[model samples]
Target: MTKQKGKLGLTARIFIGMVLGFALGLALHGFAPDSSFTASCLTLFQIGGKLFVASLKMLVVPLVFVSLVCGTCSLSDPTKLGRLGVKAIGLYLITTALAITLAITLAVLVKPGIGLELHSDASFKASAAPSLADVITNLVPSNPIQAMAQGNMLQIIVFAVLFGVAIALSGKAGERIAKVFEDFNEVIMKLVTILMNLAPYGVFCLMAKLFADKGLDTLGSLGKYFFLVLGVLAIHAFISYPVLLKLLARLSPLMFLRKMRDTALFAFSTASSNATLPVTLETVTKKLGVNNSIASFTVPLGATINMDGTAIMQGVATVFIAQVYGIDLSLTDYLMVILTATLASVGTAGVPGVGLIMLAMVLNQVHLPVEGIGLIMGVDRLLDMTRTAVNVTGDAMVTLVVAKSEGELDEGRFNDPNAAKAEEEVHLPHGHA
Candidate 1:
């Protein structure tokens, strides 16, 4: 640990990368708007950023599968898994519902979309949402290999839980396999540590490419709507979550957020919960003092289903779209939008572009134009990044709550300011450099 003395922590370094990247991107965009050199630099930035995100994503499948299996079999009581699932899913849905409700109420009061004189020739074709029967049917995978290859998270979750239960019942053979899985999980976490050490460069490239491609101009045209969504996201992440954490789990929200800084930054830069899963898992378990048994299971499930931030966007967008087209929606319509958006979060789990797809389903249910999505698509990349941070925060919040309820949390480690200092620093052994 002496090797890391006086060195900047990973979180501080990542923050520096973000700030410098943003400044550099703005410089390139403002000064070299039409230069071929600028184009080349942007291309390199995009490639570097995508490569970093891909590296993180490469660990997701094995991390989720192996970690979940190990967590599952470690439980002495198989029935506790059922209880954990209930609490986790229940909390997720409740928060999602609350998110959309807060969004709609605020949107209706704030009127973010009124008096907008903008016109767009843009149109979007929304894919059909799956039926309830179809969603239930697809939960159990016929071929787990195909599920893993395709990164079908819900199916992988179901299979992992069932496989773990089977292993629990298999006596000594099960114990041997479980031990092997535990070792594999440790190896996978080490890989995560390796990737995290490289996160500053990755985050720099991602933010640089984003700002270089789509700068603040995108937010100018839809300033009111953009900021409204952003405000609600902030309120949810800062206010709503903390209140719930303080109330139900009786935990310190301040400490939780402090510990979550690195994970939140990762989520923001990558803008994909699945890609950020390894870091999130590490944060929840190592830094936040949650048991691996709980973190492994809930983090993956939350990534797949807990989309409070997306739900907030859907809520605000529904009201914004209705007002933009001069359509007056009644109270019942607003209530329906709330209900539809909340349920649709789970109904369309694991689908690509799920946020907009869920938004389309909400719009269709409320008789709004599905094409209205195109209007907000301009500013969505930035909002997507912000909302992803909120989404992962929700995941960890619920994980901590569940872990606490089950007497699985280490409050001492959580409260300690330097709980995971050694884990956070990346240092090579002597003479390696």
Candidate 2:
């Protein structure tokens, strides 16, 4: 069957691949005990999934640079930029703080990590995180291209805005460059479409391998804690985001969520907000009707710094760790967890093993043993999915908030029920949206 008029849509085909891969993984893990088959299947899944992600990432630099340049240069008033910036950052901070608080509240009320006697012999060595001052200092990149190559979303964004501003000031010459950026944006989005089509299979492979190895028993041991973390994420995704979409942007939350499945799926599979940057921007722009001027800037910054989901993980993990060690944190320690996790959102945004690193900071702040982190890593992938989903949703939320403040968002697109599906139809080879 052709790509068009096929019996099954891309989403359906991907869903099938995911289910089949998962069943195969479970069979290999439990029933078969066939080492060769297991190794071959895992290798196939890894290579295919990695290739799709790499293909998506290949467009990130061009997509972010060009889209951001276009977005910034089009802003005739720099005041709008400042306003939108404040709104986006402010929302992010508030959400991160709220995320941790929700986590703490849930852990206390539900006590998910209580009564667990599992062998928690996991070694945890957390790299020291940068200070807040250091985070600010590092945002100003010495070399813009280096930032882009490094996938430093914050620094790249800072550089893109500056370059865009210079073009905005250059009169006709700047317009020429802006036109080039616009064309680049279109091409990059086409690549995003291509990548999105492969999402179901990618998600399946990632999840199947994750579950097959870890098994449901790992989750059973920390059932309360696991459920608590996941519950908080659900609340944040379903309640927090929808409210913002409705109240601030006058958009339909359902429409946005429906449209976001592909981007969220990509984020869940990759578990890296930076990897999902291109897809997020595309969803916000083409799917959610967010203006590129607002989306390009806000989406990148949000991905880098607005980690509400990760913050929730930190908060819940801190509480769970303390409980496991029989450590009773003082009021001051709880407050410190809130502060540290919120700030760590920005500090460790691009780092690998960020969730673990941020949890270490929280654990230290509350005088809990950092070794407690080992207990949770067994099911980290499951938690990471919920976290990444919240991350992408938070990105979209902040984008809308910024766009509304800038009068840049298109309400018609935000309201359309089909807006989200429209993003998937366009051929995007890079797995962007």
Candidate 3:
């Protein structure tokens, strides 16, 4: 018992940080109100929180590029890459389509927006979505360095895969380069380990600032809309993913969920798929027993393209906003929403404010007033966090399925509760454990 309680593990520490930070934020909002002192304190917290998120972002591009290169180079059969990509991407699109369909069906039945009359003076102007031609053209980077500089994940993935394939096809020279990439991969993962140790403080600051600024009123004002989205997200994460995992991968859903606790918390706190990529990569490969070859490719691509949680929000929010505005969508319009959102998952990859951006596109397609988005924007931050958790969960689920299909999954490591614990001890600095 004493050994168990001797030190706080990463997951427990992070949960405590989140709970304390939320309580602190609520107390400040309720007691301090508009005090200058509260304002100053929150400003400090925001800086610290943003910095921590930035630190994570700094690792994303290099980690994805190098890890991907390493994984690709290690692949002896080049044909496997093509097959793997097809399966991983196909599953992502199917699941996303399913998610939006579920959301729309539930929204139409529940009618969360039927009677509520909401008027917003605020306006939303969506950035122009790229044409299909433009999206396809941009897939192959004109300049790989520029893609990395801009953090264009899809383009980066393309270049890394191609570059790694070239290295794999090359002779002795390729072998040397592959060795260098493997070394880089190891170093970068160690850096991820270091950053994770700081996560408690980062999670604390982020939650504190968010709750301090937004408070509970935002949720209260949009209770129906908020809960509807939350319910759909919960269903997708808990039901949809587990069902697929059990049927397709023959894996234990309970074990998958148990291992996901730490990764899910990271996603919830960050609310950016890109920001969560490093941790997701670590968890899927290290903790979940997915081979790096499969995880390295699927996880990053999933982060770039998969938006199941966002699709759910788009479906429910579209219906909610339409009902609020007294605009009824036809069956055709509903189909269009599903189509538009599913395609937009890929179309809007790497775009900033992706959920709202895709929502704008869907509204335009269905001829709903785009400005209605302003009505629900207030509570989006919270919903974004929840949806992000779902998104990463989907990422892991797909990784498991694909790995299992390819015979890349390690059942022994995956089924062992002590797998990740033992790995962490191995990776720990000398004298730490």
Q: After superposing candidate 1, which stretches have Cα over 4 Å from the reference?
A: 1-6, 347-353, 429-433
Clashes of each: 0, 15, 0
Candidate 1 CA-lDDT value? 0.89
After superposition, the stretches of candidate 2 with alpha carbons farther than 4 Å from their true spots are 1-7, 118-120, 350-352, 420-423, 426-433
Q: For residues 307-406, could you state the per-residue lDDT of candidate 1 as single tens digits?
A: 9999999999999988888899999998898787777776655322568877888899988889999999989888888889999999999999999999
Give the distance in Å from residue 231's predicted Cα in candidate 2 to where it truly belongs.
Answer: 1.0
Tens-digit per-residue lDDT, 232-349, candidate 2: 9999999988887788767778877877776776787678787788888877887778888888888888888888999988888887887777778777888888988888888767
Q: Model 3: how far is 12 from its true place, Å?
A: 1.1
Name the weakest run of 10 consecutive residues (lDDT summed) in model 2: 420-429
Candidate 1 lDDT at 371 equals 91
Tens digit per residue, CA lDDT, model 3, 271-327: 988888999999998888999999999999999989999999999999998898888
Pitting candidate 1 against candidate 2, the one with the higher lDDT is: 1
> With candidate 1 superimposed using the best TM-score fit, by how many Å does residue 428's alpha carbon deviate from the native?
3.1
